[model samples]
Target: MSRPQLESDVRSAYDEVADSYADRFRSIEPEEAIDIAMIEHFGSLLQAPKKVLDAGCGAGRMLPVLAAMNCDVEGVDLSPGMVRRARRDHPSFTTTVASLTDLPFPDSCFDGYFSWYSTIHLPDSELPLVVDEVRRVLRPGGVALLAFQSGTGTRDVSEAYRRHGHDIVLERYNRTADQVAAALSVGGLQEVARLERSAVSPHERDGQAVVIAKV
Candidate 1:
């Protein structure tokens, strides 16, 4: 899809699912486990970053925890409703409406970045640009924690996600370990650790992958 189409799909899909999606997965359990794994894996690479950017941060589920750790944390999402909810739930931080293709921040603006289960909404063709944008916004030696569902091929729009009022056409690319490593390398990130785990949700039975990378 072209940029306009991509933006349209995202705006529509997210606007539709904003309310229910936030209510469903706004807690810290699943992501907290992932975060803990990330912190342990990348602790040495990260000299205790003080500022963090949660890219594609839906409902700000992880924002409060980062803030509690005394990190100056903020979140950005494509959905206005999601941003609103993030603000309501994590009242101490900043939340903005933004997209990964065009980050609102400047180069080297943050010490760490977290993008959990968000970039999967983008089609494979869009992944590289988003990755580059992520790199562009992080300071040298900054760390990024990324997560996504693992699948074999690009997915067409699924009836299930559409029914839930998601406007975006989600594609699942079952990634091999090497493919992920190459993708990160192209974006100037070096992987420090990789975690593969069984999916906790039936909808995600294919499993999930988390990577800790340094910029």
Candidate 2:
């Protein structure tokens, strides 16, 4: 499918189930360890009161953790319902309905940007534009955290971790570590670390590689 169609499908899919999906993964336990590692990583590079934008922050699960760390955090997601849930659940932080392809904030508005597993929905052709948006919104010397499948395949809607809840139809743009690194470089980001995390999904279950980049 084309990039535009892929984006539309993604938005529609998430919007349809945003409420229930948010309720299901609303808890942060599954990602606690990863979030902790990310906090440690961010804390090492940024200081208190640093501004952060959590791209694709579904239901605002990571807001409180970042807020507790003394960072000024904000979240954005493609689904309006998800934004609504996030706002209701995390009144302490700010969130809005927006897409990674076109962030609504001004240039250099944040000191750090984190996408978690958000960018996985973007096709390879469109991924650079999203990354460019990240770079455009981040201040110089900013950092980013992104996660995606590691392999070679272009996938349509797919299921994963069924035990977690209803089957999620997430777009899978499985790419190699090197390809991802090159794509990151295209958006003016340099690699900080690449981690491979184990999964309970049908895809390569061994690990989900994450790349930390600096803008």
Candidate 3:
């Protein structure tokens, strides 16, 4: 499918289940200890009161995580319903409806970029565009942390939502840590650290990978 079509599908799917999604995943769970640790490490790399953008921050669940690290964080998501939920649930921070490939913010405006499971929907051919946008908005010496399912191809992730009584088709694209690091490098971000772990929960079907890079 085309990028536009894929994005539209994803937006619609998330919109249809925004409330349920927010209710189901209100916080980072215990199973995500390693992922949270990486995010904490990413926060440690930045100075206090750092300006951070939570790119594709659905429901704004992770905003408080950044806030706890003394980062001034705002969020943007492609789905308006998700943004609405974010604004309602996390009113302390500003959340906007925007796409990662075409952010509305100015250049070099952020000190950190966090994309937790956000880029999983992007196809390999389009990952660079989003990474370039990240590079565009990050200041010199800024850091970015990306989390996604680690593997080699796409998977149909619509079943979980379907179980919640929502009829949606969601496809998540998986990439190896090396592939993600390479894309980050091509977009002018230097890889600093990476972690790849096997799935440890019954809810998870694939290994997880987190890549930390600096601009």
TM values, all candidates: 0.84, 0.85, 0.96
Q: Give the per-residue lDDT of model 2 (tens digit) for 1-215.
A: 45434666777667767777777676666553764686567756764458889899988988887777777888999888788889888887789888899899889888888777787767778888987898899888888877676777766654543444545555566777677778889889998877766664553443567777888
Model 1: per-residue lDDT, tens digit, 30-91?
55476576654543455556678888888888786666666778999998878888888778
Give the winner by TM-score: 1 or 2: 2
| Best model per TM-score | 3
The whole-model C-alpha lDDT of candidate 1 against the native structure comes to 0.74
Top-down lDDT ranking:
3, 2, 1
Overall lDDT per candidate, in order of appearance:
0.74, 0.75, 0.91
**Residue 183 deviation, candidate 1, in Å?**
1.4
lDDT of 3 by residue, 17-131 (tens): 9999898888786347778889989999875459999999999999998898899999999999999999999999999999899999999999999998999988887899999
Residue 170 displacement in candidate 3 (angstroms): 0.8
By lDDT, the better pick of 1 and 2 is 2
Off-target runs (Cα >4 Å) in candidate 3 are: 1-5
